[model samples]
Target chain A: MTKRITKEFADLQTEPPEDMKVDLITENDLFKWVVTINGPKDTPYAGGLFLVHVILPNEYPFKPPVINWKTKIYHPNVTNDGKGTMCLGFLRDGEWKPSSRMAAALEYVRQLMIEPVPDDAVDPAIAEEYKNNRKQFFKTAKQWTTTYAKP
Target chain B: MAYTEEELAQYERLSNDYVPDAEGPLVSPRQSSQRITSEYAQADPVYVHKTTTLPQQFSQYRTVKGDGNCGWRALAFGYFEALLQTADPSRVLGEVARLTSLNNVLDSVGYPRDIYEDFTDETLQLLKSTAATLPVHDDGAALLASFNDSGICNAIIMHFRLVTSAWMKTHADSYVHYTENQSIQDYCSTHIEPHAVEIDNLGLQACIDAIIKPAGIAVQVLYLDRSPGEEVNQLNWPAGPSTLNAPYNGLSTIRLLYRPGHYDILYKHEDIDILPAAAVTNPQINLMSGPVYLSSSNVCYSQQGLDIDNFYIPGLMSAGVSLAYSTDAYISNAIYAPSALPITSAATDPYSVPYSEPPKAIVESPTLEGPWNTDRFRPSQYQVEVKFRQVMPVRPEPCQTEAMKQAGESKAHFRNEDFQPQIWEPGAEYNVGRNSEPNRRRSS
Candidate 1:
């Protein structure tokens, strides 16, 4: 594989867009991706988008496969099936060894879409609307990205 | 408090007679059958391997205000020597020897710790919302009963230095003069009635609210003000005396360990005093001394999985993922101690359909009438048509093995009796006749 998708696409191009994001939804399946995040703009999802769907595991770079999120955005750190079932802190329990790469879970899910962490939400009602109605939870996540994403 | 059927069969025979391997069932060999893995070595195989085992029992409450002497064991030994000097002098000296043996069994059951300036602003927002729900491995009596169950009594370590500092300032007449002039029990008998009480109250906000209630972590206490050269205040840092003459030895001296939203780069490129006389960036005179608490717990053990990276140094990789749970519990107590066991075991299903169950029909064959039947009960179909005519072009001995080389072709190696429709009619009759030709030329 272009050596683990070119080092998680050169560490999603040297991290720091407040944290992470290794683009490429097309360029012929370096292993089916989509990415697009924003949220964590200081939270209550300051800008909110969060797309997600990376994939890659047919034994790529060996072992760790499964990164979800096809967009149905809400979190307790993800996992209520709008996909990107987010769970880092070591790509989640089994604690993902094999020196955990995917360019550090693509900069730990882009610093978890800029910290959508209400501790680690698996969706406690979007971690209690990002901990109690953060500006009408960013106006219902900008009206769920103009009604069901993919624009 | 449930477990009984002979204590869930002696905790399922001590959670299935030890299985962790990579040198862990506590130094292996308790008559080891190589620990377990012959498809989960039988008799009770439902998932569980390492076991975390919580509940060291809690429920012993007391938060009596001043004079009853509240220094929650010297403010939980000076907030675990300032959170073990911001991390990793050997994992904050083993969480400061597990919060100093659970604050010496709650200071021989006296329990009342120090500095509880009464409290209100809804008990200082329920002690900074239950110390932002503690739990990255809590034990110190559930972080002192989650700060005496939120209404916060004996304000242990001045309610975590007024909830990890930034000094809650919304002054609309100081939030109605500290909420209609103090009533969190007369504001802790009027401003912690002159400091000095029994401090060190162990129970780090109930181990950070059981690591934020099942990792649903929602900690958000933000305050920012008193700008200029960006706030590094630990009350003008520099204070070390007792606890073996403090200083790096008794830990807790850190002042500005950045990298969590880079605290607006020490308040936007440093420079303070934001009106009405403010101060706070004075860690022994403005910045520069580094290492005053910057241990973001190694980006929280890669968010707790442990592939390890980013330890600007706070308990370097959570003290190497908590001393890989006592050096190699097959990589952190067999993967973060059965997912930090609260009770998960339903046989660890997680989703349940992994190769569900339907596959036992291997080789039944009851209606076979022609592909070389040897006139009836298959005398091994004439040695499988002379071993498919001596392996026609010669390929399939499982494509020459190295464990089937890479597993392709699970079937079709040779079935082409010209695709099978001529049924041997032209050959059945002629074969019955030539069969006598000395067993077809003595099997060719």
Candidate 2:
């Protein structure tokens, strides 16, 4: 809807996808988008494509956007109950300034696909599972993505 | 964040002022001075550079020249050289390089001015005599168990800059205040205890910082308590926030402590039987002992104190018969001191450990925060400007017996006669001191 989001969407559309697809779930609303990201190369998550929903706020540039995996994802920050609330690590609660943007937040989630910050994470169960049983998390994430997001 | 063009230029100007010229004097005050310079005195120029001269050979002799604290430098070099002689051959070169640079502040000019004074020949002899037996190296732990003998073993983790940094961060508040206030006594009494705690807590990070970030030299943190165990405890061992995650030098720390009878520091090495004073072969305390103001012969002496005595006049000395005229320049120059270095001497890097060349500044490039914290490294920058200055002294009113009674120390009573020694006789005319009294006067 805004100039910055429009520009970001235009850029994402132009980039070629190796293992992921990013586009708006609802064609009329640009703020709610779907991103199907593949697991990083060589990681236990190899060949796994994970789908997530990204929700942009009304106060777009000032506040950070929220991204939740619609297709059951196992991560320290993401809850199993499907409540999309995730704490963005970069923004210190009392210390976060008004200048942080949405694009940066999205890019961090994209990076989370490759490496997970378990030390500074919130949900220990998922983090533990991700740590102790990496093969299982990759199998689950990939199966959910394939079953729920391929269309 | 970006700077405006004007702000950027201002930064450039400030940075440009810091680059030292190669041909300048070997010693000079690193900072500016204004009122401390009197019309009668002038400052000599000084220079700084790397020296190949081994410290052991120079232990017996000391150079009388330089601008700031020369005595401390001599002592630092003396002890370091002694350590090299006793230590394993592999540890010699690195320890020599480290100790030499650690005492860089002393090389700036005439420093530790208090010890430079012409005390009794006995004091001078004591200083020179004790040079041989002085312990110079603090015992260090081997970070890599297999690489024990090389100086780099424990030193790899014993980053002096970081240790100083931890000391500074832990005690920055008090040190800044005392040093800023120019009161060494205050620094000693008020700041030392808590300062020790800061070092204990942040030792690891401080060492890492010293080893890696060369430009940011660590502060010299001296501990009052001398037990290596106590020093280790005071250093707070595995310095914080990320302590458990990282293994620094095998077990993660080397402890420091003090040795008795001598006023120096010691460290315990794993194989060595004895720990000795390794850093300062001779520690000097610059203060007035008696009448003749003792200071380094080469350095300018700044005197301060109000001259209450109007002019050269007659006796407040004795209640005797028929006294004629007498002359004296009754001034208490003892209480005052000139700014030895710049008034602010601590700001310059307090200590510098040598690396072959200054480390190249790393450009900050954004990288995703990694899963684990990592320690960064940089080369040494020997260039430092001293800004630490002695605090002005405070003189309380002479507490008479009556005044002493009002306060709590009532047990040690004194009569008016006992208070006679405390009176301020305000003229130089009374040249004959109490010590030079005649036999009959003494008997009475």
Candidate 3:
């Protein structure tokens, strides 16, 4: 498992995916990683960075990494407060494939920003807002991104 | 989908109230499949009908816990078991090379050696150890123990997942028809490669094509469902590779009883038929080893009344219990080709109840109520002719010569209060000579 993690960590560092930066939290703890996804261009949340926290369980590749949003954003799929933990379909239990790579998972996380699936949202209020009122949704999302996501 | 706070609380309560689908060993020890029949004995009519007929074909089954890995575990266990049944050390020994070579398929599909080799090595090591117990005479204790160990079992299952995934990917054209809606790679990634996802039909077929079929193991799944049928419908994959001359090889089949969402291993009586050297291992009567035995198609030979610890197979022991089929059929065919009795003809009140119709031919005088009522019939060309009347124990006559006893049970031994002295009862409904000829049997 350590060998697998080391290989994954090295790959993430040398050939990182676009719009994402990943680093181990501490040299002592390989399981805890700090990741940042660049908010996509032309979206209301553009030009801001969003920090994501990831904790890989020892069973890893066999299990999925535990992830939460550290940066507050007005996204329907992510929780509005607390740990900001959320679902991305594939990362959920019973759906996570052991063969899935962390790189591909992060890539999926990046795509989540491009297209927030309001249909499967963690925040019903924002999900409803995103669906029912697009103009107000963009304004509030841009405001929150500017306030909490500027680094 | 998101839920309101109240809905979330209710959902939480519901989730808390729910228990898991299946819980037990990843794979369990073998058990009498008759237990399966009685399990559904009180269930819906369909289940009762299907399960009652289950023991007719499959005599035993080993449960695989319903933890969503049943299908994979059943086939994997079956593969190892088939290797044991093939009984050739070379065949069991030969699998390591065949399995290791399949790593090439894993490689071609880009499953990195690091991720998959750990599982592959575990698989190979298990096979090597299993092969060490060459000419497996005892019923697979070592194999069962290995599978019960979660770590070893999970690794083997994981290795199977990898192999199946790779098999489906490289053999894309073979499976493209099944995955027309999505790319084969997409289907493999989500369904075939998932550790938790239970195996679906396509995945099962790919796994068989990849590992089982090439190894000369026939696999079957008995779908015990609510579909219209007197017995469980079955899908069969006949014995692998025409070159592997395993004729009349019942043990090679990995019969799985699929009940909706679960899969359990099923075994024929032949599976429990111990090798001569290991006859003492099983406590059950060694029917095959016995010099004279009686069986009847009319009677449902059920072990339902067994005292788990001290139970004898019905016909082999003294007949304290009486069971009869509706029609007088070949006594041997019931034991030999148990599947021959169509569920339609065999009345639903199986096991203990007497069929409404009288037997076409009676082995013992139909009116015989005497202590020793068994008949001494002539042996068929294939085997000895003896019909089971377990209620009365067959006693050898003191005056009979040794040669007379071997050729046929001494006619003196079969006599009762009403035993007719004549060999052929002229114009009688029960003809002794015709009944003795097993090759020609009445349909009803």
Candidate 4:
């Protein structure tokens, strides 16, 4: 398990995903990581840097890692509460495979921001507004990004 | 958060179902027969049929827990068990060398040494120490305890998984067709290399062929499934050089019972009995020969129940009896001439005589002719007489000649080109060459 974690960590450092930066929470603890993703251009959350907490389990590859958004933003897939869990399909228990890499997983999260899935949403109200009132949803999403995701 | 009832239920089931406990025993003892009986006793017709045949076919089965790793666990347990059977330190040492060399395979596949080195080391260390203590009979319990250790067991399983997966990747063309047209890389990433993923048949075959068979060990997988068959299906690993050819010589067999989604170690009643020194001299011949009778015993009863008297070929029956008592020596002699046909009729006609009367025809025919005559002085002639009297009941003969003809034709078909032994070359279209573009994609 440590071997897998070390390999993933090295890979992450050497060729980190575009516009994303990851740091270990502490030198001794390889299990927890602080990741920041700069919202893609052309999206409402553009110019915002979103913080995500990555917690890998002891059985690193066998078990899927837990990723939570530490910075709040209006989105259909991310929960609005303090525990902003993202509901990505691949992270689901049955769908997750040990061969899935951290870089690929993080890239998937970035892609989700470009086009959020409303059917499988963590926040139904946001999903409904995004579906029924697209302009208003973008306005509120931009406002929240400015208020909470600055820097 | 919003989820449909079905999604919620699925999530609940996934969280509640068994997650393979790493600390659990690597291999558990054979559960009671009642465990299988209870599951199938009143269930589907297919299961009931399987339950009925299970007892006669297998004396007992030791299970590997339903952890997604059961396939790897079962194979590893089988490997150690085969080694223990040899009780030869040299063989264990040989295995250690073989495993060490296999690291090259992982390297060829671009698996970093740093990632898998510790696990491989743990496996090789265990083998080295086990070999140091030869005639591992006394230390059997301790050895099993070591296997139960989570770190050691998981490492060994992972090593085997990598070896199997590497073999598949290297020889991709042979297996890609079976993966529903998926490319070899896609198949390996999804099924073979993934941790906690259950192995499919192709992966199992690759493991047996690349790892176990090369170690000179044969595995007999008893498939207990819902297929419409009176007896369980038996597949020998490394599948013969050709389906018609016999398994590699001098290879000890490890029997595994395969259920729908799980694998367990199978034990024959004789496996439990302590063998005499003489019996141990040639264990392979003894083990392969026993299952033939065990499988046939059920077939005999079932055929009788179905009232299929004509299905019995006296010649084949006599050959089976002779092969059983005298071993392969009789088979070499019997293969020479088509004399078994005359012997079959001459042998089967005596059941009409009273038990008090000696089988005069059988005795007279063999003694009247000289040893040089093909009809006389065959070992099968004597064994068949004895076996026929003891086990065979009187039944009307079918067209024995026609049956023999069909059997001969089937044997010829097995020798056809389609059944030829497959040889995998590294640069073949199906195989992933070291310098191939796909190889570049794999590393990336």
Q: Chain A of model 1, TM-score against the native?
A: 0.31
Identify the CAPRI category of the predicted complex in candidate 2. Answer: incorrect
TM-score of 1: 0.18
Best by TM-score: 3
lDDT of 1 by residue, B361-437 (tens): 11121221222112211112122223223322322222211222222322221233333222224433355554444
Q: Which scores better on DockQ, 1 or 4?
A: 4
- lDDT string for model 3 (B63-120, tens) is 9978778899889988987776543433554567688889999899888787787778
Alpha-carbon shift of residue A39 in model 1 (angstroms): 67
Residue B314 in model 4: shift from native, Å?
A: 55
- What digit string (tens of lDDT, one per residue) describes model 2 on residues B104-167? 4322332222211111112222222222111112232111121222222112112232234334
Instruction: Name the Cα RMSD for model 4.
Output: 22.7
**lDDT of the candidates, in the order given:** 0.33, 0.33, 0.65, 0.61
Put the candidates in DockQ order, highest first.
Answer: 3, 4, 2, 1
RMSD of 2: 27.0
Collision count of model 3: 5
**Candidate with maximal lDDT:** 3
Model 1 / residue B243 / CA error / Å: 3.7
Ordered by lDDT, highest first, the candidates read 3, 4, 1, 2
In the range A1-151, model 1's lDDT, one tens digit per residue, is: 3454565565556763453355767876677766666655455444556567777765443235467877765445666644446654556423343223566576676676556677545555666776888777667766765565534
Error of 4 at A30 (Å): 2.9
Docking class of 3: acceptable
Q: Which ten residues in a row have the lowest lDDT in candidate 4 chain B?
A: B290-299
Pairs of residues at least 3 apart in sequence or in different chains that clash in candidate 4 = B173-B430
Q: Give the better candidate number (1 or 3) by DockQ.
A: 3
